[model samples]
Target: MELTDTINQVVNLTKDEKLSIEKYFTVKTLPKGGLWIKEGQYCNHIAFIKKGICRIFYNDQDGNEISCFFMPENNFISSYTSFLTLTPTKENIEAVEDLEMLVINREDLEKLSKEVPKVQIWRRVIAENLFILLERRISMLQSKTAQERYENLIKENGDILLKVPLQYTASFLGVTPQHLSRLRKNSVK
Candidate 1:
């Protein structure tokens, strides 16, 4: 969905407000396997995925890149902590597939909020939704078994395995790739 449409879905925007908001976003793309935000980079922009998928991951002490979240088309992707605090990101966001997005940098977003005060409501709603999602992720990781997590992933995103690699999906589920293969085989039976 378009940015204006997404904003309207969250909070009703006047015609002028919609036009004003659109100008803040610019089109961007990243090829598959490209890093959108590398670790230690400041993520100053929040982008809406127009197409494709990306995974947000971080390197463990052992230097394993473990994916924690996936962003699919029509959704927003950002390192919320870095974007808000103006600090370096602890994670990398990589395009799992060729990506197309509309991004608004922090400065323009601030200007947009000032220009269209109601944009604040939209921003708050987006942040709240992101918070809820992160909370669910933490709860799942803390309480769920690997098999249960795999099932939940399947239930939530049926085509995700097709889109993301097995290794990444396995890491996200707190399982080995071999174990994930077994889970998939069992799920099919």
Candidate 2:
């Protein structure tokens, strides 16, 4: 995706502000299994996916990995709470496929927001959208049956089942791998 076009979708910027933004973003490549944000490390940057998929997850006491969400192409990925508070995050974001992303460090984003007034509004809008998405995920896990949740996932992202591994997708659906198998079987019937 074009960097300027993506940024413009978030906020309208003047010529100088556009140049200021262009200077701050860097393109980065991550191989499969690369950790964009490691558990217990500060997330210094937010990444916008240009290609491929990633999972945000945390390891439990028993070392079982639980996926919190998936970021596919054109989505943003970050340990947002850690990024905002400048603290280490328990969450780890790992590339599930070889990926290319546009990344901007928190400090650079902050500087841009300060220099460009519209950018600040853009940041707030991003945060609000993130919160809504998270809240809906929480609600689905709480209120929806596993079958419903799986169906909802398919409804929301039709190609996700093909793109993401079933194990990770099951975790996101709050179900065991075996349970996901049953769900998929039932769907076919």
Candidate 3:
């Protein structure tokens, strides 16, 4: 599984360490439209997406929900800024589809880190990955045209258009729904 493989690839966990760490994780599920974490709630658990999509969004000053990020299957997700600081998250995490995930609570993660120091390294790797993703998204928004952003999204995960709502995709691309429709239509032509 991706969870095991990613950890092993990052930290080179020993067989015993891998087996022992399994106790710290639990399988959890969320139906479509279910919220995993709400805005202003502490995100105590980090989840590895086994099968589904989760959208991370927050309301802007205009009180409009803005799609900030999406986590597809095989990736790890958490309100990283909130999880690491033990503060309320600004974004709400919701399942875009029925989700099956492996979740590890922060307290249990600390305990596992103590037992296996390699876990610390893995945590750092995960955090760095989150930063890289955020940075790339910011870069796209700051420099790329809407068309370029859409092209990048399509190149990266075209299936998202089929699975996720167009409105959300438009928000993610930093465009209005109508503009996204034009982009989509043009792509087909």
* Model 2: pairs clashing at backbone N, Cα or C within 3 Å: none
Q: Pick the candidate with the highest TM-score.
A: 1
Candidate 1 residue lDDT tens string, 93-179:
999999999999999999999999998998899889989998999999999988889999999997877899999999998888999
Give all TM-scores, in the order shown.
0.97, 0.94, 0.95
lDDT string for model 2 (61-132, tens) is 999999998888887788999999989999999999999998999888888778777878777887999999
Given candidate 1, what's the lDDT at residue 123? Answer: 85
Q: Candidate 3: which stretches are off by over 4 Å?
A: none
Q: What do the candidate models score in CA lDDT, each in turn?
A: 0.92, 0.88, 0.90
Q: Candidate 3 on 31-132: residue-level lDDT in tens?
A: 999999999999999998999999999999998889998888988889989998989999999999999999999889889899999898988898888788
